[model samples]
Target chain A: GAGVSQSPSNKVTEKGKDVELRCDPISGHTALYWYRQRLGQGLEFLIYFQGNSAPDKSGLPSDRFSAERTGESVSTLTIQRTQQEDSAVYLCASSFGQGQEKLFFGSGTQLSVL
Target chain B: AQSVTQPDIHITVSEGASLELRCNYSYGATPYLFWYVQSPGQGLQLLLKYFSGDTLVQGIKGFEAEFKRSQSSFNLRKPSVHWSDAAEYFCAVGEEGGFKTIFGAGTRLFVKA
Candidate 1:
């Protein structure tokens, strides 16, 4: 792909429903990251994956939030029993090898929990 | 933990006027600094980055930033403002060889015609 791709650019789900956001990173990218942006707030890191290493999930806000990636290709972030507070933009980014490499971001999935 | 602070929540500047946005960071070791811009209903675009060597860095769209190690600041500047430049700017910091990047709250720029 020319750039990072995210699915379901906009999603409106009822509270307690489950939602999944997908990200297809740039071809050959070795690192992937997930972040959340609330209205008028900064981006909060959710998780990071580097190559075949164990993913860093320390930033996940709660037990309801989980994510998975398959061999550095596509990734999915799943939110179970979503709440109103979960209404925000979910962004995905990828880089060549992490570290100081520049990150390319996707358009993001705007989830609105009604 | 690494953190970034953008003091101003919003700034208004006249078109053709010079502009500057302040940013500060707290990190234990050398940090990788970055500036990104986000237009309404759009994803973020990287403006510039500072990893090593020179303290001043240039970015796309006629923007530049200087890394001041003494103050732990990476302030973005432009010689002249444009109406199209009205967007949200974010400053971010990451540790060397680390995957986590912490972004600031963001500064909204409004350009007046």
Candidate 2:
């Protein structure tokens, strides 16, 4: 892909329903990141993956939120028993490496939990 | 912990006027500074970044920023404002060798005709 691609640009579900958001990073990008942004708020880091290593989940808000990436490609974020507070734009970004490199962001998936 | 601060929540400027947006960062080491803009319903687009070397960095859309190490500020500037430049701007600081990037509450720019 020319840039980061996210699936289900918009999703609406009732509370307690589980949902999965997928992200396909740009070719050859080694670092992938997930961020959550509430309406009119700044981005909140969710997780980060560097190559095949264990993802850094330090920013995940709770146990209900989890993410996984295979190799250096596709990644999926899963929300179990979604809450109203989970409604936000989930953004996926990829970069060549972790440090000073610029991040290419996806359009993001807008999740709405009722 | 690295953090960013955008003092102004919203700013309005007339078209063709000069514009400046302030940003300050707090970090222990030399920080990786960045400016990003987000249009309505669109993802954030990088305007510019400062890693090292030159204190002044040029970016796309006629934007530029100066990295002042003494003040811990990376303020974005443009000589002339355009209607299309109205958007939410964010300031960010990335930790050294770390995956997390802390972002400040954005500043929304309004360009009046």
Candidate 3:
């Protein structure tokens, strides 16, 4: 696609259940990012993937949150044993690698933990 | 740790009035400042960015932002706003070669007729 694409535009899961969200970065873009935005909150950086390098997972709130990216194309964010606090819009973005400056974002997955 | 701050939670202005949204950043490396807007049910769209050289950068939708390194600020401005400009704006700061980029809480702009 010409822009970043995120799957499951909306997801509802019960508390303690696990959920997965996917993101497809813009073709040829080598920098992918994951962020979580809760109600009335700012974008909280989750993880970043640049080329074949290891992702920066420093922003994951807890052990339950994890992510994986295959090369520079697709990425997935997994939340284990979700809680109500985990309910938020998960956004994915991509850049043209290297300097990784301005980003192109996806519509995001609105996750609701019940 | 690097961070970005948007002072105003919300602002309201008439359609023809000028607009200014404040943003502040705390970072050690050379900063890459950006202003992004999110319309209702839409993704974030970059309005402007400041990498280097000229501090004043122009962007789409008649928006512009100035980078004031002395004050650690990058504020978005518009000579006159329109009703379509009503949306949430975010200020962000990133490192030159780093992967992590921090964002501000965002300022909600409301354009009134």
Candidate 4:
């Protein structure tokens, strides 16, 4: 696709259930990012992937949240044992290069934890 | 540490009127500044960004922003806002060392007819 694409545009999961979100960055772009935006809150950086190296997972809210990227292409964010507070819009973005470059974002997955 | 702040939670502007949105940041040295707009149920779209050289940067959607080093601020402006401009705007800052960028609590704009 010409732009970043994210799967499961909307997802509803029961509390304590696990969920997975996928993202496909713009073709040939090396940088991918994950962020969560709760209602009335700013975008919170959750993780970032550059190439196939180790991802920057410093922003993950807890141990239950984890992510994986394969060969600088597709990425997945997994949330284990979700809670109501986990409900938010999960956004994915990509850039041609890393480090503050122009970003292209996906429409995002609106996750609802019931 | 670097951070961003958008003081206005919401602003209402009439069509064809000028618009200004305030943004402040706390960072050592010159920071990478950016302004992004998000329509309801959509992803963020970059309006403008400031990296170096000229502090004033032009962006899409008839929007522009000036980086004021002295004030530690980068504010977004539009000469004549259209009704379609109504959306949520976010201000963000990035340091030189890392790819992690922090965003401010966004300002929601309403276009009054």
Tens digits of per-residue lDDT for model 1, B56-87: 99999999999999999999999999999999
Interface Cα root-mean-square deviation for all models: 0.8, 1.2, 1.0, 1.3
- Tell me the deviation in Å of residue B79 in model 2: 0.8
Colliding residue pairs in candidate 2: none
User: Candidate 2 lDDT, tens digit per residue, B20-84?
Assistant: 99999999998989999998878889999998899999999999999999999999999999999
DockQ of 1: 0.87
Candidate 2, residues A1-114, lDDT tens digits: the string is 888999999999999999999999999999999999999888998898898564578889999999988899999999999999999999999998746678999999999999
Ranking according to DockQ, highest score first: 1, 3, 4, 2
DockQ of candidate 2 compared with the true complex: 0.74
Instruction: Kindly list the per-residue Cα lDDT of model 4 for residues B1-113, writing each as its tens digit.
Output: 89899999999999999999999999998899999999987789999899999999999999999999999999999999999999999999987757877899999999999
How many clashes (backbone atoms < 3 Å, residues ≥3 apart in a chain or on different chains) does model 3 have?
A: 0
Q: Provide per-model DockQ scores.
A: 0.87, 0.74, 0.81, 0.75
Q: What is the lDDT for B16 in model 1?
A: 100
What local distance difference test score does each model get?
A: 0.94, 0.92, 0.92, 0.92
Output the lDDT of residue A27, model 3: 95
Sort candidate 2 into its docking category: medium
Among residues 3 or more apart in sequence or in different chains, the pairs in candidate 3 whose N, CA or C atoms overlap within 3 Å are: none
Please provide, for model 3 over A1-114, each residue's C-alpha lDDT reduced to its tens digit, 9 standing for 90 to 100.
988999999999999999999999999999889999998989999988887464577889999998888887899999999999999999999998777477999999999999
Index of the highest-DockQ prediction: 1
